[model samples]
Target: MWSQLTKKSVWFIGILFLSLNAYAGHHGMKKDIVDVAAGNENFSTLVAAVKAAGLVDTLKGDGPFTVFAPTNDAFAKLPEGTVEMLLKPENKDKLVAILTYHVVAGKVMAADVVKLSQAETVQGGTAMIKVMDGRVMIDNATVTGTDIKASNGVIHVIDTVLMPK
Candidate 1:
């Protein structure tokens, strides 16, 4: 009798979970990096650069690449016409350099980030690490959110975009 009751209880719980999930809206879901880049209001420039560099597939690949993605506003911080200039077909290499500058090779978490003085970027350049009074910074940008896990890699959101030297 006890085993029968336990089986019934488990069945009831499973049905209830399925029912709840079935009724809930699907729109409120965590998106992958490609979806995030395409939809998020903050990442327009980054998305454009990814497209320009022919890196959309690469970034969407099984990267585990640490992306220091910049916001639209961050791109605005560049000199006037810079974004337009970089997006041109003739400027593809430059776009690749600038975009890759924001990518680090591995999945570096915030805890690990605090310990390191610098990290090498995918562009074959190094990003300077700075911590000040509990705030963590990469290059000139402040890390707004850290350890955002993705299927391929991780994303650490930054307030400003980093440019290569």
Candidate 2:
């Protein structure tokens, strides 16, 4: 009886350990940049633009990209017909340029961003970064949130849609 009880107790403890580890690991897993964007309601417009620009595959690729994602409200803040115009099939190149402008090549978190004066975006232009009064600014837009980790990259939420010059 004693041997049987010990074996049962060991089995129960082993199962409990595995179960807790599995639950913890699942919670700790990070979604990639594209998945993160698609999962969030605030990025709906950005997601639509990415699809319209034919950049879904590229963004979803194995890139440690850093995206300064703009919210739907940010897209709304553009000229009344700008988003509509950009979505047109004929404007694919322009849309691609504009969308790429928001992406940096590496996973630049807020802490590292604050140390930079400017960072070159994938669109071949540099975005001026300013830190003031504990606020971080990328061009005219403000960084509303930061360090949103993804398996393939990171996302920093911005208040304005960045435009390529």
Candidate 3:
């Protein structure tokens, strides 16, 4: 009777431990940059562009990337048919270039971003960073939101879709 009681107690403890670990792991897991963006309705256009450009995997991959993400409204601000043109199959290269232009190769939070004059983009172009009238600007876009944490990196919301020169 003692042996059977001990075995059952041990099994119950083991199951409880495993269950707790699983719960903690699931809740503690932070979503990656792509997942963060995909989960937000404000980034729908940006997410669609990332998917259309075949960049979902690269953005979701490991390693910190700083993305100055434009919202759907920003995409709407573009000339009529511009976003549609960019999403076309034949314009994949252009779309990729444009998308990558928004990403820097490392995780740069808002504090660090304000100190920089320029950042080299993943697309190999330099983005001009400036602070004017107490607001941060990345190229012509205004940094409306900052320090959005993600598993892979960080995202700073911008008011315009940055175009690579």
RMSD of each: 7.0, 4.5, 4.0
List residue ranges in candidate 1 displaced over 4 A: 1-31
Q: Write the per-residue lDDT of candidate 1 for residues 1-165, one digit (tens) a residue.
A: 999999999999999988777765353334556666777778878898899889998887766788888888888988899999989999999899988998888778888999999999999999999899899989889998888776567788888878898
What's the C-alpha lDDT at position 68 in model 2? 98
Clashing pairs in 3: none
User: Model 3 — which ten-residue stretch has the worst lDDT?
Assistant: 21-30
Question: What's the lDDT for all of these models?
Answer: 0.84, 0.93, 0.95
Q: Rank the candidates by lDDT, best first.
A: 3, 2, 1
True-structure Cα RMSD, model 3: 4.0
Clashing pairs in 1: 64-152, 64-153
User: Whole-model lDDT, candidate 1?
Assistant: 0.84
What does candidate 3's lDDT look like per residue over 57-129, in tens digits?
9998886899999999999999999999999999999999999999999899999999999999999999999
Candidate 2 local distance difference test against the native: 0.93
* Collision count for each candidate, in order: 2, 0, 0
Error of 1 at 42 (Å): 1.0
User: What TM-scores do the predictions have?
Assistant: 0.78, 0.84, 0.86
Q: Pick the candidate with the highest TM-score.
A: 3
Clashes of 3: 0
TM-score of 2: 0.84
